[model samples]
Target: MDRSTGSGLSFAKRIYLPRSIGLGIGFMCVAAGLWPLQPQPWVWALLVFNGFLWPHLAYLLARMSKAPFKSERRNLLIDSVFGGFWAAAMQFNALPTVTILAMMAMNNIAAGGGRFFFKGCLSMLLGMLLGLLTFGPAFNPETSMLQLYACLPMLVLYPLALGWVSYRLSIKLAEHKQALRAVSRTDSLTRLYNHGHWKDLLHREFDKCRQGQHRATVALIDVDHFKAINDGHGHLVGDSVLRLLSERLALSLREDDLAGRYGGDEFCVILPNTPAVLAADVMERLRQELAEVRSELAPHLQITLSIGLAGYSPMQLDANHWLKDADQALYQAKRQGRNQVVSAAD
Candidate 1:
């Protein structure tokens, strides 16, 4: 949901209430400036509307608009206009005028930096002109202690509130970035690491094994006659078969073991600090486990895994060479017969 819309309030909307509360205080300072003049009923009414009701009204207007986010930005600029008009109406009272204008400037800068600052300045100036045209120019350089105290609350509290909002936004952005990275590395169907991520892990594991003189095993497992299964059953059933295998495979592995879906009907695993024999035993157990699985679509369908297991050798030059050894073993398993584990020769 758009945060700007009534469906959901966004971060900006979340910050607005604190800003409005501070603004109400700032407007009270403006009223203090205008008090000595004993302004007319219309002026008093305008002050009440701007000081008390405008913030809520602006939020609702944006929420009701076709594009709530965009409308909210426009509303911000309108706020600037009103701020400028009030500053002028107060006869450019030095303390109140500066506080009102500075707050508007700070708000625009926070929203869009220099660009929005410029646009907001333009709106403010236009509003100042409207005030000047209606009521003529007047100036009061002095401000009372009460008026100064009235402006103090906004100056101190508003920035702290805005800072909190910005901090939360940064944290949210970082979390979203992390989520996107995870999504990129994962396969949609199997919810396992994708081929590229698996390959990266393989490379890293190979490096660690070579550097630390540790044993690691790599295995490639293929679903025997997967094409025939898809042909016999519908694609939906074929997908279910893959999901079941992926789930069972995950459950069969140890905490430190890494598994990934290499492609259609082909999955890969990496086992650290394990010899070829131990890897073979693990793969064999996994094979039997998979064979016992009964498909919902065709309960009696014979399903099995052909796995090729190879341990890292010091003589192997690179990750690719080690992978090649496992691939060759996998081909040997298929050639010998489906549904068996083959260990590659060192």
Candidate 2:
């Protein structure tokens, strides 16, 4: 559905249970306050309906509305109206009136912040006017022990329910943020680390190497005649080749190894705690495996990789120098022969 409708549905679902619980328990508090006034039978009936039945009806109204979020907001206002009516009906008894109005205000603030809270207050004022007209204005500030006891459940349980809903919302937001971070750092085509994130890791690895804390090797790999393949077979076939290479890299590399798409047809890898000699052997195996593979999309097309390796050296002035060494080695591999692995240290 559209954004507005999706938000409305989510808002409705979040509010429904808390509304049900609050109203059900609130019935006792209102009833206890009204009991001293000897309210008419119709008033009692109205109280019962508002306390027990209105929550479900409100939920149905919101769910069925074309504008559910707006409908739900209207429902909240009605709840505030009812709260005001009950407070006035109780002759503004200190405990029950405060409990009812406080709960309604809490809900309003939580739902829509300060602006909605003020709207709810206006609605409550309108309700108070209605109650004044119906019951005739009077004030009874005293609260019986029974009324105080009746207010306890709503005061305690409603906040807890609202707190739980807020907590769940916070957790879901955190998970979404983490997922977005991962997506931002990942290449869409190959599901490998994108160029920027890989370079970031390279910088960190370079720092470790410079500090003499670790040894690492960097490799740059380029697809052989990738432009020709793309021109002959189409970009779709070229994509399949890249995806296939990435899958093999993921499967072949150690868990600590980092691989990323450097750009168009070039990929980069960082092998931590490895020497150039060992890295060359690893790349040679990878190169051979890729050369033997054929793409399902272009079965007649053969794929090969030219790889260059550079082991960390204390003499390197910066990460860029180390990367330049690998790039030079990659150029050397391409010049010597398209399918071979060459090491800068060699």
Local distance difference test scores for all models? 0.86, 0.94
Question: How does residue 90 of candidate 2 score in lDDT?
Answer: 89
Q: All candidates: CA RMSD in angstroms?
A: 2.3, 1.6
Off by over 4 Å in 1: 1-12
* Cα lDDT tens digits for candidate 2, 115-219: 999999999998898999899999998988999899999989989999999999999899989999999999999999999999999999999998889899999
Which regions of candidate 2 fall more than 4 Å away from where they truly are? 1-3
Give the count of colliding residue pairs in each prediction: 0, 0
Best of the candidates, lDDT: 2
Candidate maximizing TM-score: 2
Error of 2 at 162 (Å): 1.0
lDDT at 74, model 1:
85
